[model samples]
Target: MTTVQEQPVSTGGTPSVVLHAAEGLHDLIDGHGDENDRTGRIAEPVVEALYDIGAIGVFTPRELGGAEMTPRQAMDLFRTLSYADPSTGWVTMAMGLATGLAGAFFGENAARELFATPRLGIAGQGTRPGRAVPVPGGHRISGEWSFASGIKHCTHLHTAALDAETGQTRFFIVPVEQVTFIENWDVLGLRGTGSIDYTLEDCFVPIEYSYPSLSTEPVTGGDLYRIGIGNFASINHGGWVLGVGRRVLDELAAVVRAKAGRPGAQTDTVAFAEHFADAEVRLRAAKALLYEVWEEIEATLARGAEIPLRLHTLNRVALHNATFSVAGIAQFAYTSAGTDALRRGTMQRLFRDVHGGTQHVSSSPLVMQSAGRELAGLEEGKRWVHFSLK
Candidate 1:
């Protein structure tokens, strides 16, 4: 069993201090190293620390008793948390994004009830394989939703289902008590995420707790909710990949320096040095691109304008850049670190984490296809990223 240790929160300081404390949480986990690989035991301390410092609600609306930080702030926090443990960062990003989406898409009553607590972690599945049958005043939802991350600690859940009559897909919020947590998240990477399945059986969902997928109604009340769902999805996962990439580069640099004076280093000294320099350049270029996209997103949010198509395009570009950077760094690290990186160390773990980061649906090939289709003026099929512009 992994030993869990919660970091104490510091009071009476600037917001940067709070952020610094949050970053420190990552360092603490990184110090644990391989002990963090145990499934279902790694993220408790980190999640507790985040709850203690109120970092989990960074994207929740202020009116709902959350900080309602901007997308940039949310991304920074995820990146910092991810440097320590990708599972912890994945769960945090998943919960934070779901909370923000709940506030944006759900009815006011549902939002109030869900965000009433200080840290309400949510797990959701977007695939609408479930069925929502209309009852008198609500809907009877029944189906098994897979890939519900952080379900063990979640108080609320968001699930997508299709109406049998009209064939319209909708999202529903259900309490923890109403669903059963199934242990289905056994994987080689991100094992600590506890992304288990939840079984829903004749769950009665109130009318207010459900909304059509891709809400067309304007999110009038909260500025945080006004942000489009596609934009949120694009930006949230970008931070996760960026953090993993950063870790890969850091580990590569350390390993290269350690092996610099070895006999193996003498054969192709100039070529190896060039490879290290090239990796650094590529990593820096990726960071610059991520920052440029972030600045554009911030500017758009600052102006209170709807998410333009260009923002989605930029998000796609940012994710692609980060993914390629991570792959490049991983290749260099694995090659330069020789056989040592194959052992259970920082580089090995970082390699797994970086690959896992790229496998996320948001960062997958579909995003690239969507961007290409949009650029070519071709009609993209139904997608989760499609939010109605009202």
Candidate 2:
């Protein structure tokens, strides 16, 4: 594992400032857990706090007025933020990852405009369901994007669409103003994410703001567009799951300690002490697995090599480890806390958040199956499965 630099309280950089500002926001959000579920407005405060603390630009390339931290550094940041609050960690990780992708894959002009601000939020949808038709100077894009986390606070969106002219899939940079947030993120967990629907109505996007999925051509005007999409996406999602898993483990430990003496307090005979110990072992194992995979990702980036198929498998494994850890921690905490955990409190909220975090497609069973099939030498049945950072 890489020895991450001790992040200063304030690095005097935008990323550092984000971390500094978010220092107390986690507690504030946790304090408002009830409203977070009812109004989906917790993300707004979280974004503001992140900006106040300088936590948003770790992945922003130096050329884009931000730090050029490695994937490992980004993961370290995520782990820290997640321990504070998983929702904040999730939104920050998703936006940061999107920013990194934009810096690495979008055109130079697009990169400059997108990252021009000290703190920018970008949201993305993996499924390319939008339509893009070439026109005189740009493309006419129109579609509805769903599950766009942080959409309420996003300044830009990275959307995928199929081009009508060449039938090739492409990604477009759309200003948040061009899309209308539909307030549709109703779910059991991560409700604070404000992951609503976005409607793009006949939006005209410039040609320079888009890139074909397989293009290796350099962006004409910016240095931020040097990173590849596949590799960036994998790393971003990896950090997100890692942060959430770590947070879940922390919550579980706290709950166990609090309830360890409930039934046999004076006797020190906690009924499920062994179970809690086993769960801790599993959580540690999951953390180790995720860190190993992240190290592989960092090594690949350092070598300037494309993310290989094996690395994708490893990324999937890391995500699997995160989900498994969340499930394990929740199970251990719930079992140890008994019915008390389900009451209206921090434990209940944490339980819901962890389960919600796992529902993301990045951490879904489909990802595991894809990795497994690749390992077994099965023919890639879907174009999405055929995708690799390399």
Candidate 3:
């Protein structure tokens, strides 16, 4: 048995894995976030500590030693963790989402072995294109992938490629030893994610270890998997943005309160009060709509009905809203704090981190454009990142 022990993890009603993680995020987890940022890698103690909270199991099925959280539950977990720290939250989000997708894409035995350890998590780049040549039982994988978040502490790494023989995209499940970490994670913010590049050299992945990215349905059959990829992908993006925005607000509030007694601080305080209130309203509206769409997705899935167009519509709108809202919040906080905000390890980092989120391809405004086009009866079935992620 793995050192990561089992505990009932729920979202409040039963103290599910996400809730457990929420309650278990203590000083160690909180303090190490900055350490991870400063060092450009997550500390071993922090990784191990996450195991205790079942962070890796959020989307993993119970049969595979995972928590099998509903897609929405997993999003809530990411949001809560981001509230503690965005770097840890990004790592957790990458691990959970990648592992979950692996579970769905890989066959039972392969999935089982991958999730054999209670705390096992995978990391790799999915964005870069690679080439796979046919071999005896599998394919030879050779490619360089970038932005592999949390690769330093991951058990395995994953990538997708163009199959030479069939011309299909194949998922390559590779042991960490076969891949080389590039030590190129230097960044302005969200520095702790270890979002670096990795290369595979003549790596042979067995047939069982590889699968067509779109050929299979999730082995862990559920309403969550039944929901289309577009709907499922929106939650985590919104959650991360929401949490970071909340943190900006929380930190700015505390700073404003601390400076309330200072000479000439009241003017800034009054301005901050108004901006903060406005920022909260926007953030909450985005969050409320996000969850409301999520609930609709669950209901639609539960009723065995086709996922609604509105689900994707709401998802795209919420994602864009959250990203912009967080950007606005960071700006307000920065102006409110002025020179102190410009200092290192201050509002500046949060500003960079939130803007960094906007840099994500998924958070791109193009997503909303495609969704809008689809809503207007245009060709959009497989034109977006959702198809590739699925």
Candidate 4:
């Protein structure tokens, strides 16, 4: 339940803005690629550039003055941007998804009001590290969540807590100011995400500002919102990993070609050839799994039918498998490149980013296990996994 603002968001999103942002991202990746990765921060300039292109709030829905870009479009954008730099790609995906989640909760009118702010974006964690107590007009929420990506740039945070009165869970939209950000994001890869841990201490969230993340009745209705958030995140980030895999494969191919002409290079080429061919087969298979699942989900939605457990499980499998496959591909490329990649090149960074991105729970085998259990017509077994499916 969201309070409707009298002012409605304008309903218009020109494709040109997205296209421009894509091109700008390419240029930025080329110019600031290493800086972004090493610094582990998305600079203000890049944020400003994204804002100028109206690429910051893809979630708000066209009717609500947000881009309202479909999951397919956003995923493609994320993949393309990731080609230049995965860190930026990671941040972009998180921001876009956060915005979309907010749009899904904010209903129509409030969404417009929120997205109307220049350069507004959202980011937060799904895991509950605290509790929300029932209060006068709303719930007083206090919790800590880890791995909140792109928190440095978002306008709001989307979090959840167990209700003090009821064992049930509820989600909340908190203004960024209410969050106590803890700079604890050091990591092995995906450094640019700046995914620090954050805390919220008894922040009062009005009823209009909170809802269940898994609710069937979204305040705002659209094809995008109609698609459940779990499915949406699965496919959205799935595209990202596919793109990253493509980049790593392509970069390795270039290296192989460059080294082919060198004296005594045929041996390495032969080795790389084997690795590339094998990786190609695996990557293609993994990539296809994602699109197949995405298409089925869309078809189900188009038919106004419930998304079956099979589709959800398949989506989870594809996303996790794709991530695992890509990370393996990067590892193969790294081994093939050996000392060459070890010398700290783009391939090296891609190797690290791929590995880092896979660290997300979304890419974990636990998700795949849940999917397998569901497909086998068995219980989810794990309470946390079962809860997410709800």
- Top TM-score prediction, candidate number: 4
| TM-score of every candidate relative to the true structure | 0.86, 0.83, 0.90, 0.90
| Every candidate's lDDT | 0.69, 0.64, 0.72, 0.74
* lDDT for position 346 in model 4: 86
Top-down lDDT ranking: 4, 3, 1, 2
Model 4 global lDDT (CA atoms, 0 to 1): 0.74
lDDT of 2 by residue, 1-390 (tens): 111122212222644544455555667656665676667855466566665555656665555544555666666677667666666667777776565556655555556665665457677664656999899988998888887876666778878888988998887878788888787777877777777877787889888777776554444212223334544544555565556655655665666567555665421444466665776687677667877876876676567675566666776667667676766678667655656577866667667777887776666676677667777777354333423211
RMSD of each: 6.1, 5.5, 4.2, 2.9
Residue runs of model 3 more than 4 Å from their true location after superposition: 1-17, 228-231, 266-270, 379-390
lDDT of 3 by residue, 45-128 (tens): 878766666676676655455666775677778788887778888887787767766766566666666666545778776655
Superpose all Cα atoms of candidate 4 onto the true structure and report the RMSD in Å to 1 decimal.
2.9
**TM-score, candidate number 2:** 0.83
Compose the digit string of candidate 4's lDDT tens values, residues 1-390.
343445443333555577556766677765677887777788777767665665655665555555766666677777777888888878877877777677667656556666666566788887654698998988998878988888888878878788888776777888898899898777878888889899988799888777775665556546667766666666557877888899898888887777777777742656667767999999899977887778777778788897776776777888888888898898888887767789777888889889888877776667876667777877553322422443
Which residue pairs does candidate 1 place in steric collision? none
Clashes of each: 0, 12, 5, 0
